[model samples]
Target: MSKVVLITGGSSGIGKSVGEYLTEKGFVVYGTSRNPENYKEGKFPILELDVKNIETIKQTVKTILDSEGRLDVVVNNAGAGITGAIEEIPEAEIKANFDTNFFGPINVIKAVLPQMRKQHGGLIINITSIAGYMGLPYRGIYSASKGALELLTEAFRMELKDFNIKMTNIAPGDFATNIAAGRYHAPLLDNSPYKKPYGNTLNLMNTHVDNGSDPNMMAQAVLKVINTKNPKGHYKVGEFMQKFSIVLKRILPDRVYEKILMKHYKL
Candidate 1:
């Protein structure tokens, strides 16, 4: 039997691309969306699920297990993006981002772990972000949420090792997707102290996403990792420089790397 796969936030963007690719490769794929009705034409079934909603997460997982009897792979791709100065960004928005990007994935994992343990084997792929490795000026909240997930996966992998369940993080750089459209942007305030710099950084961030590489690249990366027998704890997919930036952070002094980032963002 083909492996049964579940992808959160799969109605469109990276989740959609990964689901379609996995389906083509003979995997049984199901994607989730808050508004499944809007994606009636999607290639794979888009189940109703809101990452922030525990009940929906449970229902979606149960629905899949009832039909397929097993779920071999789960891609926790549901997340939200937030961009604003750390101080200026509302505390509520920050918490909301964490709910979707951090706690949400954890809830999904919890919902699926029992079934995976019963099967004695499964794979959990977390769709983290390259920004998670390092804090970006305006996208700090988004980075922190994904970074938390990355760390959580490290701990989860160790805990699930004996069950033959593998957990890994796949951090993708900017990809050409509708993420920018859905991201919450704190309004550029006329008198706020961060008005000018925040506005400029925000524009740069959107431009990067607009000119990002194809989402199919991330799908291909996901498939490759899934096929590996002993997958690494973390994998990154993106342009050379984007991936290299992570390495640079490791080798460079704190202030030096900070300078490079500041120059890049023209701050």
Candidate 2:
């Protein structure tokens, strides 16, 4: 029996590549996106969904379960980035980021758990970021959102162990994805308080994202997790620089690491 895996934000970037890889691996993949038709060539079934909407998520899950009979994996990959000083950001933007990154995944997980519990097995692969572990200057909003996901994954993993459900969080460094281009900036562009300080920093961050690792590699990493008999609680996937960054943070002293960050942002 082929496993059924569902991925959110599957229209592009890491999600698209993962969906493509898993489909090639013979899993019946149902990918969710606001515009599913755009990803038609990938051969996986695409379902229209916006993770922020709980009703849409529930309906999509119902459709998948009714048609497929079971789900083996759920990849919560539908999230976006928001940049700026926390204080300068609007409350609405903060909620929006959390809605998509944190609560959105929670909603999907909640909707799927009853079925997973009954099946006595399932895998949840959350697409988190290294930023979730370490905070950065202008990316506070984004960091916090992913940070919440890190804790959620841990707690859920502990709670679901008895049911034989597994949750793994992928803390990818910087993978070349469309996230930076689509990153939400403050809507109050003209009167933004952090406008002066954040201007060049945002550009610097975007440059790093633009030149980061290939999304396909991250996709392959996802496949590895899916195939593993006992997937790890977390995995870091990206270029050498990303791996180096995680290592350096662990080994370097506070001041030294601070200097490295400041130097990169030209502070």
Candidate 3:
């Protein structure tokens, strides 16, 4: 029987690319999108899923399990980005970011654990970000969300060790995706302290994302990790992110890392 893989947020970007790649690799792939109608016509099944809804996640998992009989890999890849300085963003915006990026994945994992644990083996690959490793200006909320995800991934890795389940966090720096232009931008308060100081940082973050690495390369990396006999707990993707994480780990200590980050953003 073919291995079963389910990917959330598989309508476009890295999720779509990974879904296409896995389907070509002979995995029985099931993809989820908020609107299944928007997905490109393909051989694999595309189900309607909104990760923010826990009930929807449970139903989606149950549907896949009913059809596939066994769930081998679950990719929690649905996430959104919000940009603006910390003080400029409203409380609602911050909560929205956490709900989609962090809590969404957590819900999916909780729903699929029973199926995976019953099978005694499965892979849970989370699409985190380089920001999860280091904070950046104008992306405080997005960073916080991914940071939460990184912690969850690590915790699950250790907790699921004896269950024969593996969790991998793939942190990609930049990818040639439309997410930059389409990122959720929070309204900046005129009286906000960050309005002037963090303005430049916001612009830089937007520019870099608009011109990142190829999304397909990220998809290929996903395939390699899943196909490997034993995947590492964390894998860094993208040229810039790979180099940045290395430099942060080497040249700068914990306190100095923040100094360098602030300097780079002119914060």
Candidate 4:
């Protein structure tokens, strides 16, 4: 029997790409969307699931288990993006981002763990952001939310070791997707102190996503991770420089790296 895979946020963007690719490769794939009715023609079945709602997540997982009898893999790809100066971004928005990006994924994992533990073997791949490795000026909230998930996966892996379930994170750099369209952007108030710099950084961030790599690259990477016998705790996929930036952060002094980022963003 083919392995069953569940990908959250699969209505479009990276999740859609990964689900389609996996389906082509003979895996049983089910993707999730808040409004499943909107994606009636998806390559694979798109279930109704809002990661923020624990009840929906439970129902979605139960639906999968009832039909498939087993779920071999799960890709926690549901997340929201928020961009603005840390000071300018509202507390509600920050918490909301964490709700979707961090807490949501954790809830999904919690809902599925019992079944996965019963199966004795499963893979949980988290779709984090390359930005999670380092804080960006305007996208700090997004970075922090994803970063928290990254760390959470590390701890989760160790805890699940005894159950034969594996967990890993795949951090992707900017990908050409509709993420920018859905991201919450704090209004650029004319009199706000961060107006000029925040506006510039926000524009740059969108451009990077607009010109980013194809989502297929991430799909290919996900397939590779799923096929591995003992996957690493973390994997970074993207342009050379984007992946290299993570390395640079490791080797460079904190202030030096900060300077490079500031200069690159023209902050």
What is the C-alpha lDDT profile of model 3 across 71-114, one tens digit per residue?
99988889998888676677887898899999899889999998
TM-score pick, better of 3 and 4: 4
- Residue pairs in clash, model 2: none
Off by over 4 Å in 1: none
Whole-model lDDT values for every prediction: 0.95, 0.87, 0.84, 0.96
Listed in order, each prediction's TM-score against the native is: 0.99, 0.94, 0.92, 0.99
Question: What pairs collide in candidate 3?
Answer: none
Candidate 2 lDDT, tens digit per residue, 1-267? 999999999888898888888888898999998887776777788898998888888889999999999999999999999988788788998899999999999999998999999899999999999888777888988888998899989899899999999999998887788887788876436677667668878888888888888888878888889889888888888777767787898899989998998888777
**Mind giving the per-residue lDDT tens digits that candidate 1 earns over 1-267?**
899999999989999999999999999999999999999987899999998999999999999999999999999999899999899888999999999999999999999999999999999999999999999999999999999999999999999999999999999999999999999999899999999999999989999999999999999999998999988999999999999999999999999999999999999
What digit string (tens of lDDT, one per residue) describes model 4 on residues 1-267?
899999999989999999999999999999999999989987899999999999999999999999999999999999999999899889999999999999999999999999998989999999999999999999999999999999999999999999999999999999999999999999999999999999999889989999999999999999999999999999999999999999999999999999999999999
- Return the top candidate by lDDT: 4
The C-alpha RMSD in Å for every predicted model, in order, reads 0.6, 1.8, 1.9, 0.6
Hey, what RMSD does candidate 3 come out at? 1.9
